[model samples]
Target: MTPQRWVYLRKLLSGFPSFPSSFSSCRPRVFSSSQSAADNMAEEAKKLAAYSAVDNNVQNNHVVGVGSGSTVVYAVDRLAERVRQEKLNIVCVPTSFQARQLILKHGLMLSDLERHPELDVAIDGADEVDSELTLIKGGGGCLTQEKIVAGCSKFFVVIADYRKDSDALGQQWKKGVPIEVIPMAYVPVSMTIAKHFGGEVSLRMAVSKAGPVVTDNSNFILDWKFEHTHNWKEVNTAIKMIPGVVETGLFVNMAQQAYFGMEDGSVKVRKAPVN
Candidate 1:
């Protein structure tokens, strides 16, 4: 992760209109020229944060947890470059099917939790990160595995564009907290969350496909668009206590650090607030 190496990588990506193949298809549509420029700026910011997080946190011979989404795509690219130049012997543990594909596409060595139960670090992307380092993840439908990997890692780091940094959870990301549940219990779970939390509960539907989006673990997602904010920690615990709830997107106080790529071309680092 040398400065020269980063510059070279940045130059390589500067001309591309989209990110890596991992998420190029899902990026927002640009209507006007001005809107296209803004999209490119956001993509650049994501690359900067991803590179900075990988450079500062990853070490040789470390077992790393590769997270899902667009930001993690750049992290995987940087890791692959370091493996080629520095000859690092790092093992990658993917949090989802997309993560696994990214690892294999880049020719990185891939392992599983069965082989490496402990991890040195886990670098992930979040939908939103509050001041306390509480994260709302699972935008890519990988929340359950992402939380498990982060819980096992010694340190969890988040990378996002400046837009995702917020004072509170729902301020920036309006998609609400994604809740993965058993397929059979979706109706009851939605009703219960609405009764207890007071939010509009919608079953996440698929874009390209006909029905709902199925998770890697064969579960359905319930995106609870909460209206008011409460004690996030308590809400997270209460939601998980539900019988059919597999996992929630509410990552309360899990991240140790977060890197946000700003519009000013500088990467801002935020450490977890001490309790």
Candidate 2:
């Protein structure tokens, strides 16, 4: 779907009753303010700080893209605090409905990529990150817009807990790389992914519902698990050549850097050379 049509589809989905009210409201009782949950969240918050340490470049009127995921909640909170304390004026873009809500709740100015074609920076979370900085994202089903914003940004900063870091992209995120595809093309796409990519491929099924997982863009998700990835760029190019593929989770050479928050609250930063 076109980006404009995807936005419209998200608006329509937002009106649906089945969609959870908010991330907080959807959480299970077990995680509600429990000591373990709080500690984990605190560590995640620290990770977010490490992620946002990118030079804000405030003079240029930064246009930032925020992504969706449990870990990214901390990044939103930190950004909100920064906005309040520094009185920073910036245009914030979102990769999902949840992200847009975060932008509003944090009092950051909302912007559409259509209005701002270029983005200064984007801070987001990944399902997994390899030593080379290739990533597996879209576990939250926002990969399409996330890729758009990350691709458009001058720098993309990824934030995650230590568990997400891996020697290779598919190792940590064993659920597989999430690929957004046209609903009708799922079978062909899955077959191609398996035959050519030499991976296990499956249509992501909704755990709560009986059908396939539907993305905010009204697309189906295919989770492809490759035992090892030799060339992420080649994998990305191959997937894009498939007619059904909308976007893939493999973020090859797109990230400028990453920050991983350890369980003990220490943050580690990794940087790539500027081209």
Candidate 3:
């Protein structure tokens, strides 16, 4: 399905009683006052990385791909700020419903793959980033669309805080790799992945609602908790080969660069090795 159709279908299904607005509401809540100092530092670091990347890459009359998640929130905010200050002509392509809302909320020009088939750059957030620049994304359940937009872009950049920057995929993010699958095939898909990958597979359940977490594409999520390391590129290919699997969170060799927001207010940049 086209990206635009996915957005429309998500909007339609959102009104159903089975699907709650927030899937992870059962997760422990943290108030701003009760948040630790380190949390505050991470927030600032995210903003610093986002602002720096935008200043360095985004230019006038560029088609940009806006990714989903919390860190991308800061990136969109900076994009809006730049648009206001420099009056840059930027067209944004959203990877999810949240991203589309962000583009509309910030009053930025919103386009799609049909209108702009090729993007200048795509900036997204990752759950974990290893030394080789391999990524584990879709922590927010937008993997399918996020992958599509990133693949279409000439340069895919990742932004994250220090907490998300790790030496390996499972070092920091313990939730495992998110795999979007057709709702009816989740059980079989889970079994197939666990059999092949030798990792615990679980259907991602929603906290606010009584069913599984639904993606913007009206699909279910299966998180594969891998215990050992393997060739990520091979694994990504293998998972995609499975039936009913729409997309996997394993992003291997896709990002051209990554900007990590450090605790000391430094932005560390990593680029993919030239082939």
Candidate 4:
């Protein structure tokens, strides 16, 4: 797709119904003092717009993949609106616990990934995204399932705010790339990340609990901080080669398009070049 067309498509895809219409009456108003709240509203609007654009292009009864994270909350809301409006008949599949909650709370019908092996579209959020549309995901600890859903879907749409788009993936998200691994592999993985990968890595510890952070799948999480990432594909491949590594946050060539909300109340979309 041409760059101009990509932007146009993004605006259309991210278009969503207003909050009060999709979500229930309990929808929280944008807090005047909270930047996060405002950002969330903008993000949600962009996500809805993106969903609408894609929904119109597809036939009825498409199975959709819903991803985890705060931004994807809006995506779920949009999907629910589509269902409520009867504009679409779709079986929604979730990537994690939070995603499931959004589906349930929004009153959308849910389906299992096992039941619907082929998904038409998957909507998700990224921790960071490079210019080429490569992403660093899993910040909410749902990378494994998110990747699974995205891999199975014919189109993967990522929704994020302006902060997520970057010159490079690692440069935008400084919290480090979240890596899910077997609990027993934490120490070994940490060693490899530091020695072989030449970066500072640390086990993510739960502030509320004494042990390391536990993922939705009962695995442990490691946050690896690389001072410089010259080759993201190589780094991602190397991490995947390690034993006991369940999944890395690095999402290379998975997204077909992205919608980012600007501070000025406008939304921008970017589409990957057609192969």
lDDT accuracy of residue 270 in candidate 4 = 85
Residue-level lDDT for 143 in candidate 4: 91
Question: Candidate 4, TM-score vs. the true structure?
Answer: 0.81
N/CA/C clash count, model 3: 0
Better of 1 and 3 by TM-score: 1
Q: What C-alpha lDDT does candidate 1 achieve relative to the native structure?
A: 0.92
Q: What shift in Å separates residue 192 of candidate 2 from its native position after superposition?
A: 1.2
Error of 2 at 22 (Å): 44
Q: Which stretches of candidate 4 lie over 4 Å from their true place?
A: 1-59
- Which sequence of candidate numbers ranks them by TM-score, best first? 1, 3, 4, 2
- lDDT score, residue 255, model 2? 89
* Candidate 3 per-residue C-alpha lDDT over 1-275 given as tens digits, one digit per residue, 9 for 90 to 100: 45643453445434434425486662333222224444566787899888888888899999999999999999999999999999999999999999999999999999999999999999999999998899999889999999999999999999998888888889999999999999989999999988888989999999999988999999999999998988999999999999899999999989999998876567899898777
Residues 106-183, model 4: lDDT tens digits: 877799878999998888888888888989887778999999999999989888877788977677799888899999
Off by over 4 Å in 2: 1-60, 273-275
Which candidate tops lDDT?
A: 1
Q: Which model is ahead, 3 or 4, in terms of lDDT?
A: 3
Q: List the residue pairs that clash in candidate 1.
A: none
Q: Which lDDT value does model 4 have at 146? A: 94
| lDDT score of residue 238 within candidate 1 | 97
Best by TM-score: 1
Expressed as tens digits, the lDDT of each residue in 1-275 for candidate 2 is 35643453444344334535566664554333344444544465455544455334232368888888877777777677777777777788899999999889878899998999898888888888888788889988889989998998888888887778898776767898899999999999999988887879999999998999899899999988887766889889889899999999989889878888754445677775455
